[model samples]
Target: MTIAAPTADFLVLPPRPDSTADLLAASARQRGMAVELLSGPVLPDRLRHATGAHLRGGPVFAGAVAEDLDLVLLEPDDDWLTRLPYEYTHRDITLTTLGEARWSRTPMFVKPPRDKSLTACVYADGSRLPGDADHPADTPVLVSEIVTFLVEYRLFVLDGTVHAASRYATHGRLDPAPLDACPHRAAVLDFAAGLLDTCGDSLPSAVVVDVGLASDADRGTEHWAVVEANMAWFSTSYAADPDRVLDVVLRAAGPRDRLAVRDRAFVRPHAAVG
Candidate 1:
C-alpha cells in the first residue's frame, strides 16, 4: 500500500522560530495550510481543536505537544546503528546504558540513543562520561569508534526513496549546499539508494538518513558510511527543497490514528519514562 498524504490543516512551529522553521512555515502557507507559532510554553485551545496538524521542533517540545494533540512522532530505534551490518556502519558500534558506557577506558563517540539530553561527542574515557544528574543511568546510549567524515549529506526519505537531499556539513563544519549542485551528489545518492534497498524496511517510511564520506586513518582510504537516522520533523532542511521535506515531515508526524500498523513501534511515546 502507498503512504497516505497528511490531511493536516495546520502546521505548528515553536515560539521564536528559527530560519528553518520560518522556511517551513512559508512552505506550509504556500500549500494553503494555516501556520501557528506558539506564543509561550502554553498550547492554545485553537490548536488543541484543530482538525489536523503537524509540528516541527526539538524532541522535548514535540513530546509535550504530541501528548496533547495525539500526534505520531517517528524516530529510529535506539539500537539502529548497532544492528546494522558492518558494511554499512563501517565501524564498531555498541548500544548500552549510560552507566555501562561509563565503564569504558578508551575514547569513543558517545551519544544518547534518541535524545540530546547528553552532549554527543568523543569522551576521553568512561570516566569522562557525564554523571546521571539530569538523566537516569539506565538511559540508552550509542557508543561508536571514532571515524573522520570528510563530507556529510542529509537525505529526506519518503516511502523508501530520497525525496530531497542537501550537503549539510564538510569536515565537521556546517556548510549547507544543494546536493544536486555538489560534485559528490551522485555518490551520495548512490550510497543512500544501496542502504535503503538493503534495510529500508527497518526505518519509518518517512525519515532522515545522514551519509558521509568517511576517512579511514589506518587504511588511508575514504568510503561512504551511514551516519545516523533521525525524525524528519526534527531535521533541518538546509539547502534541500523545503516543499519536499515538508511532504516527508507531514507523514512522519501526523494523526496517531492514521499511522500504519508496521510503524507503531517507531512512534515516540507521549510520556517520558522515569
Candidate 2:
C-alpha cells in the first residue's frame, strides 16, 4: 500500500545509515501514510510535502524540518519537562545548572538534555571535565542525583500518552532483554501515566521518557522514577512495539511552524568559540 513518491508525504532523514531509521521509513510506506525520503536537518525541497522526519543531531530542526507542525524539541534545561517529574513523581530527581556546578568537587552524572554532541558521563568535578568535552560553562546540563536501578525502559510518549515501551538496560549494564516478560511492565506503565497526566501543556506532541526501577530498595515497596527525557527523533527505539513507536516518531520528527530556537550550547566548534 505504499504511496507513489509524487503523492506521498515526505520524511526527512539524516544522510547516515541506521536500521532503526530504515524500519521506521518502511513502516510508514507500508501504511500508505508516507512516501519519498528527504535528507535534512537542512531545508528540503517541497517542504509542503513533508509529513515527518528524523533530522540530523545538530541543528534543532523546527523550521529546517518543516513549517507546519508546531514541534518544539526539548533539552536538559527545559522547565516544562523538568516540572513534570519534579512535581509528580516521588522519585528523587532534580535539574541543576551546569555553571553553578562548575566549581563543585563532586562527581555528577552530567549530560546535555537533548543534544548528544555535549557527551553525557560522570564527571569527577566540573574542573575535571575533559578538554575534549568542550561546551560553554553556562550550559544548562542535567546533573542528576545518582540513583541506581535494576532495570530501565524507554517509552514513546505522545500528548501525554504512553504509546510504546522497551527495556534497554539493567543493573547498570546494557541489557537488551525483551519487555514481554518484564515484571516491572505494569509498574513502569503506571508510573508513566501518572507523570503524563501532570504534564499540563508542557509535554510535546511526541517524545521519549526513560524510567528506572530501584531494586535495591526494601521488598514490595520498590520505586519508579524517571531517568530522563529525550528527543524522539534521535532516540533509540530499543524494543518497544515498532508500529506504536512509528506513530510517535512521525509526529515527534515531523515538520513544525515554531521558529526553530537552537544553539551550540555544548562543546561548540573549536574554530568559532574554541
Candidate 3:
C-alpha cells in the first residue's frame, strides 16, 4: 500500500531539542515546512495518528515513536562495517554476539552495532563486558582492533555523493570546522568518494559516514579509513550546512511508502513494519 506524500511537509522534534535539531527545525521552517516541537518525548495526537510525518532525534525516541507510526528510519545493516573492504577500514574488525565477545583476551574497541545500548570504547578484556543480566548475551556487537585517528570528519551523504561535510573532531577532541574551510577538505572528499564508489550500495540513500586519518605505526605513515556509519536522523550537523543536513534527514525518516524500492533493505529493523 503506497501512501501519497502530504501536500504540506511536517517535521516532528523532541521536546528538549539539541543544537543540531534546532538548526534543522529552523532550516525546515525556512523551507516552509511545519515544525512541531514536542512537549515531551511523546508525539502529539495530531502527529501520532497522522501519516507522512518526518522526525529527527535520538535512537531511543525514534525507536519508540516508530513502533506505532509508519515511518522510514534508514540505517546501515548491523554488519555493514565489518563487510567493508580492508582498505577502507584499515583495522581488523568482526561482528559477533556479546556472549562471544565476552571471551576476548586482548584489548579491543567494542560497541553495539547500531545503537548506544553499550558504551563504545576500548576495553582491557572481555571481563569488562557487562554480564548477561544487564543486556542479552545474544546482542550483536562490533569488536575492532584499536586505532588512533588524528582527525575525524563527518560526511553527510545522499544518493552516493557527499552532500556536506565537517570536521567534528581532532585527536579525540571536539574541534569542528566546515569542510569547505578546512585544509583537508579535498583529501577528505576524495577519500570518501572512493569509498562510496566501492561500497555505497551498502548504505542507505541518506547517511552519515565518518572518516579519519589514522596513524599506522607499523607502516610509519598516516592514511584515511572509515570510522563508522550512522543514521542521518540521529547524527549531528556539526558545521555542515543545515539545509543540506535537513534534506538528508527528511528523506532518511520520511513516510515509509515514499521510500525508494532500492532503499528498502537499508530500513532499520524496528521500522520494518511500516
Tell me the TM-score of each prediction against the true structure.
0.93, 0.75, 0.93
Q: Candidate 2 — which pairs collide?
A: 69-256, 76-113, 134-267, 135-267
| 117-186 per-residue lDDT for model 2 (tens digits) | 4667778887865443456556666666555677899888876788888899988788855566788778
Q: What lDDT tens digits, residue by residue, belong to model 1 across residues 1-274?
A: 5433335667788887778788889999998987878776567765665558788888777866776677788888888998888989899998998899889999999988767788988999988887858867897889999989999999999989999999999999999999999999888888888999999999998999999999998989999999988888888899999999899988888877788997888887777611
How far is 256's C-alpha from truth in model 2 (Å)?
3.7
What's each prediction's clash count?
0, 4, 0
lDDT of 2 at 60: 43
Q: Please provide the root mean square deviation of candidate 3 (C-alpha atoms, Å).
A: 3.8
TM-score between model 2 and native: 0.75
For every candidate, C-alpha RMSD to the true structure in Å: 4.8, 6.2, 3.8
With candidate 3 superimposed using the best TM-score fit, by how many Å does residue 172's alpha carbon deviate from the native? 0.9
Candidate 3 positional error at 273, Å: 11
Question: Model 1, 183: alpha-carbon shift in Å?
Answer: 0.8
Name the candidate that leads on lDDT.
3
Q: What lDDT tens digits, residue by residue, belong to model 3 across residues 4-67?
A: 3345778888778899999999999998888877676565555656776898988767776775
